[model samples]
Target: MSGCVFCRIVAGSVPSFQVVGEPSGVAFLDSRPVFRGHVLVVPRPHLETLTDLPEADLAGYFGLVRRVAAAVESGLDAGGTFVAMNNRVSQSVPHLHTHVVPRTKGDGLRGFFWPRTRYDDDGQAATYAARIGAAVAPPTRG
Candidate 1:
């Protein structure tokens, strides 16, 4: 956590373009943006992945993410937005963060695409969705 760039930015050790910090988390403009008005939301407490986050922090983290997304949309007048958090396989940095990217009509990004085997049919797609959805749904107690 000490050597993490995001932690350094949150600690004010590194200069950032724009930053919004709350008691729970921090949001800042991405240095290497995929699109204009790109922001990264990170929790003040260091975490390596989504699973590493406590369930109680989930709401606060995502709430900040939504607020930052709204700011990006209004400030940039973007047509749309993309929110993403890469886990172990796709993780670029060993820190928990969410990317909020502003999308415009002419922007070439057509969803975060990666080469993959084609789906055989709608049934396969549905089955895959079901499995992922089951895992993604919040716990009833939480």
Candidate 2:
């Protein structure tokens, strides 16, 4: 973690366009942005990927992500936002970071979600969503 660039940024060893900094993590503007006013939210502790981050820290990490997303939408007057986090694949940096990019109408990002596929039917889509919802539901104590 010592040599990681994101850790350096968090340590104040490197300059960054910081937006939000908390005990859990820091949200800063991406140096190489897909669009202007793009922000990257990174955990303070050096977690290489989503699976690497402890479950206890997920809430804090995602809290910053939500805040930064809202800021990107309101501050940039964007129509929407494209929030994403690439793991090992296509991940420029080794540290885990979420990209919250502001989106406008007709930005020509139609192909961003390449290889798009649709559900076989509405029922299939609903079933998938419901399965995911159930998977995330809090465990009930016996």
Per-model TM-score, in order, reads 0.75, 0.77
Could you tell me how far off, in angstroms, the CA of residue 71 lies in candidate 1 after the best superposition?
1.0
Estimate candidate 2's alpha-carbon lDDT, on a 0 to 1 scale: 0.72
Highest lDDT model number: 2
List ranges where model 2 is wrong by over 4 Å: 113-142
lDDT of 2 by residue, 1-142 (tens): 7889999999999976677677768877666667666678899999899999999987877876876777677665779999998999989899999988778898766756522234455454444333322322222233
Give lDDT: candidate 1, residue 38.
Answer: 66
**Residue pairs clashing, model 2:** none
Tell me the alpha-carbon RMSD of every candidate: 13.8, 13.5
Lowest summed lDDT window (length 10), candidate 2: 132-141
Error of 2 at 54 (Å): 0.9
> Could you tell me the lDDT of residue 67 within candidate 2?
68
- Reference-based lDDT, each prediction: 0.69, 0.72
Task: Give the Cα error of residue 67 in candidate 1, in Å.
Answer: 0.9
